[model samples]
Each structure stands twice: as C-alpha cells, then as structure tokens.
Target: SDKPNTIETDDSRLDRIEEMITNPNERIRTLENIIINQKPDILNLKIKNRVHERKFWRVSQILGRSSQTMATKVVGSYANDLKNSKIQEKHEVLVKKKRLLEGSMVTTPVPTQKAVTAFYAYMSKSENIPGTHHTLIFDTAITNENNGYHPFSGIFIAPEKGIYVFSFSIRLECHSYGPYELVKNSQVVGVVFSDIRQVCLQDQITGTMVITANKGDDIYVRTHATTSHIGLIPSDDNGRSSFAGWLILN
Candidate 1:
C-alpha cells in the first residue's frame, strides 16, 4: 500500500507541471495578439505627426516671404523720400541765387550812340507856393545830351528803356520847409525832406536812386502839397541846388 501511494503522488506532480506549461503558452499567445492589434494606431499617430511637421514648414516659408516683402516696401519708400528731399533742396538754392542776382548792384554797360546824360543847377531862389505842386526848375545846364531834360518843366524824359542813376540836392534858407518827391511817370519813387524850423539859418537835403525806366517815361522832382515855401538858397555860383542823371544799361 505505501508503494502505490507514492506512485500516485508522483503522477499528480507531473500533471501539475504540464498544466503550468499549457497556461504559460496560452498567455504568450494573448500578448502577441494585443501587440498585433496596436500596430494600426501607432501607424495613424506617425501619419498625424508627419502632417503637423509639413504644416509647420509651410507656415515658416510663408512668414519668411511676408517679412521680405515688408522690408522691400520700407526700403523703397525711404529711397523715394530721400530723392524728393534732394530735389526740393536744389530748387530752393536756385531760387535764392536768382533773388541775389536780381538785387545785385553791379554796374552795366551803356551804348555810346544812345548815350543819355544830364546835369543841371539852380541859380535863383525859385519858390514853391502852398497848395500847388512845384516842379524844380534848374536854370544852368552843365551837360545835356539830346535835351532829354526840360529845364522849364523840370522833367526828364527817358529816351530808351534802361537803368539809370539819378541824384538831387537842395539847400533851404531861413524859415523854409518842404517835402520833396522824385516822381517817375506820375508815381513817387524817392523823397527828401528839408525843414529849418529847429535850425536858425538853413538846412540841406539830398536824394539818390537807381531806377529802371521805359522809353517815354517822365521823371521829375516836385514839392509836396503841405509845403508853405520851398526854394533853393540864392547863390551866384548855382551850387546850392542841383539835379543829375545818367543812363546805366539797356
């Protein structure tokens, strides 16, 4: 009986060992099936990652192009502005130079054939009455070309279109007062004042102008309306009052 019981126990142990081996083989097969089922999901995740990477690369390329376009526009605008500024500066310089040329006082050449010159001096006390425009009559003529100056009318007519230099001087005796105007074609171009109210004996005034005159224009010296009595101080030498002019250029 002891021998039989020992053999039964040995057979049961072998059966248990075989059952353990079978269970382990079944579990390994289930694990393999699970790995096989997860392969599609892994493949789908890889595809999504690739698509995301492509989209990111495309966005980067578009942003780079946009940045370049903006930079180009900025550069172009700056260049245009700089060019316009330089042009404006040049225009201003030209305008300034033109103004300076116009205002310059350089003398110009005069033609010999059409020479216009005149000089006259007053020898007597010729009075300018009140409320009347008095034209200063110069009696003694030092030089007169073509008789352009009328001593009787105290008017000098321009013989040609040209620039001219004109000058005049007057001496006032006691109690004399006047305002003198150099008239050009009925328009006043220059003025001189002689007032001996503060002074006890006399006063003197002089006027000079550079003018542009057209042909047939009349130039003269006349007394203002408010003047009571304006006259040249009587002198034997005719040196107290004088008028002179000369042509500068055509």
Candidate 2:
C-alpha cells in the first residue's frame, strides 16, 4: 500500500512536474540560459557526477548516526567551555574604621564631609585649533573644615589636531604643594612633580610638560592642596604662560 504512490524520476512526468513548479521570471530565465548553454556534456561531466555521489554518501552516513555520539561529545565540550568562561571571582574593599578601647577593640568609621568652595577656569571649546588657548581655572577660596586644607587646580585641553606642550603654575596662600599629576583622557601620562613644596608663600609655581595630541584628544592637569587659595593659571601673568607645540604624524 505504501509503494502504490511512488513517483519515478526517470520519466517525462517528472519533467512536466518540474516545468509546472518553475516560475517564468528572471531567475527561471537565467537558469534556462544556463541549462541551454551547458547541455548534455555539462550534465555528464565526470567531476560533477563524482561530487554528487560523494555528497549523497555523506548525507546517508550522517542520517544513519541517529543522534551522533561523536557529534554530541564535541558539542557538549564546546558548551562546557562557554559555561566555564562565565565563572568569575568576586572581591570587596573594607571601608570601616576602628577605635581602641580599654580592654576591647572597637570598630568605627570617621565621617567624611567634602565641599567645593571655589572653581575657576573650568572651560571647554568645541572648535580647538592648534596653538589656541583652552583654559580651566579655579578662582574660589574654600574654608578648611577642622583646619583641613584641600586645594586643586589644572587646565584641560581638548584639541582637534597637532602636538601640544602645555605649561602652567599654581599659587596658594596656606597649603603646601602636595602632588601634581598630568592625565590624558583619564590616563596618567606624566608625573610632573611628586614632592611637596612651599607653594603658599611663593605666590606662584610654574610647571612645563610636553604631549602629542590627535584629533578629538584631550589633556589636563590636577592637584591636591590644603588651602582654598590654590589656582591653576595657564601663564605666569594672568594667562601669560604659553604651552606651545606642533602636531606631527607618528
């Protein structure tokens, strides 16, 4: 009963069925041209016949595997590697403080209060040309909470193109110069000065450094001080200091 509806492929009925299923559009037209251009000799080519037989044998073997133990093993190993790759280690930083008791150890944290008293020269330019001035200054003075001094100053440069050598100075009234760090796009590029100096009484200190910049690149400086009178002036005399350099191809 199952063999009663078997369709034979070698008959002309198969050809009629193929013609009925074919479309008369560009794809069919292109295929017809190919079939006509490569006729009986093309259909009888040795390489094509061998390739077709090999492909059929390969498909038969794949179907005979019935779930394929080797294939399942390989796929399972790949999945295991992917699952193991997602495993991660976690860590925590201690933020609590401690105090000493008569006979026991007490843990506590000191309260932290931070406020920005003054900020100067916090400027940004969308159109930054070579040798142009892009200045950032902190002009406000802050009162120390519990006589604690904290002052910071720097210039941030976002340039379009060219090399730049930037130099500036900070002047504070009471705090000692703690540290000066140069960062390019949040990355530490240079440590201009790391030692403490008497920047309060001197009224001025100059810093000079060089850096290469590309299009849309930025450069800036920052500081930590004890007093509020600290300011980063780009020049010695009211933005008189020049940070000049050239843009070159690396």
- Which residue pairs clash in candidate 1? none
Writing each residue's lDDT as its tens digit, candidate 1 over 127-228 gives 444333677776667677767787777788988788888988876777777788788988889988877766668556889999999989999887774555
TM-score of 1: 0.49
| Deviation (Å) of 72 in candidate 2 | 99
What TM-score number comes out for model 2? 0.28
User: What TM-score would every model get versus the actual structure?
Assistant: 0.49, 0.28
Off by over 4 Å in 2: 1-157, 194-200, 224-250
What value does the lDDT take at residue 91 in candidate 1?
96
Q: CA shift at 56, candidate 1, in angstroms? A: 99
Q: Candidate 2's residue-wise lDDT over 146-200, tens digit each?
A: 2211123333333344445555444433333334445566665654442234434
Candidate 1, lDDT over the whole model = 0.77
Q: Which candidate is the best by lDDT?
A: 1
Model 2, C-alpha of 14: deviation from truth (Å): 99
